[model samples]
Target: MLSAIREIGRLVVEQVINPAQSSGGKIITIVLDEANAALQEVGIEDFDPEKANRYLHTDRGSKGNAPAPFAPLTEAKKTLNKIRTWLSGCEKVIPKTAADCDLVNTINRALGLDDPILKAVDAAAGLLQKKDRKFLTVKLEGGKTFLGDYEVFRKAVAYFADRKAEKSCSTGCACSICGKIQEKVSARTLVYGFDTDDKPGFIAGGFDKTQNWRNIPVCSECRTFLTQGRKFIDSRLNFKFYGLNHCLIPQLLVGNADVLEDIINILSDSHKSVSLRHRIKRRLTDDENEILEFLSGSKDNMTLNFLFLQKSKSAERITLLIEDVFPSRIRAIFEARDHVDSVFSETYNFGKIRTFFSKSDPEKRSNDLNKYFLEIVDAVFRGKWIDFSFLTRFHMDVIRRGLVKDEYFAFRVGSVNLTV
Candidate 1:
């Protein structure tokens, strides 16, 4: 077994990583880490199945060596994978606290806030309230997005109130969400963040950037609010909020792939980077377009709205991700990944929401949520999924009831092509 473990690392190094002629630079790094870590954990102070198992002493006796080299590979591979999962988090490449702090200092200095910004943040006790954040917005403008740590948001109304923007308050202070303009705290105290994709206002389902603030961009107003709001907690972290820029177009496009070159180009904008994936696969294919032209016998008029998943619903998509990194095993990786609350993926977390009984409000501090709804009409049409082939009436009705009113599941009646 010990020798088998050794062989596992060797094979992985030789077959999976080293032998791959087209391996990317990023993949090579992961492979190296896995191999080194796996080899270190597997010790050779035990039986040498490759040499002579008889030379080794077990509880039973000196068992003869296994003849075949690859015989133990199956078990070896499985054990190696388990060991790798355990060790991956032990040596994370990314540091704790999510983003870099020095950048914030530089930005604050550049903003010409002087030290008063720091004093104001300390007055507001920013550090004390830093962890009190609820919802965050992953907003981007064209190719530029604002990914930063903001204690609070300065609503458009507030900016107008400060007369900072020098523009009329389209929405006045009285009608505003409380008189929070002076304090710079948004009435919508976000406990989490809005997983805004590329489009600024509209958030998609499934694909949300849950990366550190260094990965998400933030607008100037947000940073100012954070820089000032820290006074709510402590003055020290007034300049703590800083903006970051990231390009995740490659991973997104690969996972949510389509045949259209134009679409891909639009997504991977060399001119403008757009970081957002779709909820379903609705790319127009040549065959489908041909079918449409043939069926309608018209080419002049073709309208496709291209349905995008709602931000709330999209908060639940987790199917597509990059292949290179051990994204799941990274320390606090789950936090960076938009959370899932659907029954199907809820188990991915700590089984927190998997209760036998339903709750009136079972939401949590996470990005994705599966707001299940009851669908009596659809239940009647499709019946239910029972035996491999047949659908019994009793079983069908039982399944139908489950779909309806079950917050764990969501969907009415439509073909959803999700890339899992």
Candidate 2:
């Protein structure tokens, strides 16, 4: 799964860094110049995803003041403080003689507690909340935006990547990821929310914290790819299954990136349609828009990896991992599901099975039975065998509970049992 994430990173590295390639829409830019110390609201301009790169985003940290050059106007006061911090941080990184310093100075002079730019943001707060209007950049008249400077953008990228605990850079060391001996390898290559490597106990051989990089050494280039890949997975590939979260990662069987690209497009939001049964019955124009059908369409070129994640206030937990699921297996599951639906004369779905293990309030946290439910789901997807007795106990519990109240429980139980 980690290897597949690195591959995805390689695919999206360019798009993640280059604003023009990754994003579209207009930005409500604030222009500052010699004549305009209070700032001027220049009309919206095209969004450049590459321009934001590492400069504008706050992905590494959760705190409000986590050092970012630009911020979206989501919250007025918070955005102002972040912009102030970003300018201060930029001043420390950029040399006095650098061209970026002059642009930064122009922004510093114009911004204040009672600036016109704030008023502009307040007026456009509704528009600013929109997806395309998420980014707000400070630019000088006839000069580039603060994030548009390649030098400062590079610095921001390095800043976030090096925010790791390890500082001892290695030279001519073998990268644990790609297995290549590189001149420079970074210890901070791992993505956030995947694992907890803070404690020395988690380190290999329980060595010093600084030597943690030796456990999973990765080259700088590969690090960038992984970061971008993680972003892609978070934004596009991630989905909610029942009450749990899962990332649908496409892995190529033959090392063809095009196949990955095709899967991505097929699963994209623009290509998505109604539910599978509805689309099939209605005869939708784009039959391949449904996820199950498209996934089943690919027989040999690729497979899928489902990473089920549960997030809390502190960290994310991996509850289940169903890997290397072939298209044939997906087709088989759907075929069985269709047959069961036909026999029952009522629409049957995964939710019905999930309900047996659910609490009265499904939104509540999972209890002991939740693990069993996930295990059953995994077994169904992987075609793994489950002990008959082990399954019967849960079925018996459901039937016992239904006897108390649910009048139509017999039909519900029968449908789920046959479908499973």
Number of the top-ranking candidate, with lDDT as the measure: 2
Q: After superposition, which runs of candidate 1 have C-alpha atoms over 4 Å from their true positions? A: 1-395, 398-420
- Give lDDT: candidate 2, residue 159: 66
lDDT for model 1 comes to 0.23
lDDT of 1 by residue, 123-178 (tens): 33332333332111111122122221122111211332233222212222221212
TM-score of 1: 0.15
Compute each candidate's TM-score over C-alphas. Answer: 0.15, 0.80
Task: Give me the overall lDDT of model 2.
Answer: 0.64
Residue pairs in clash, model 2: 17-50, 18-50, 19-48, 19-49, 19-50
| Residue-level lDDT for 67 in candidate 1 | 20
For candidate 1, which ten residues in a row score worst on lDDT? Answer: 23-32
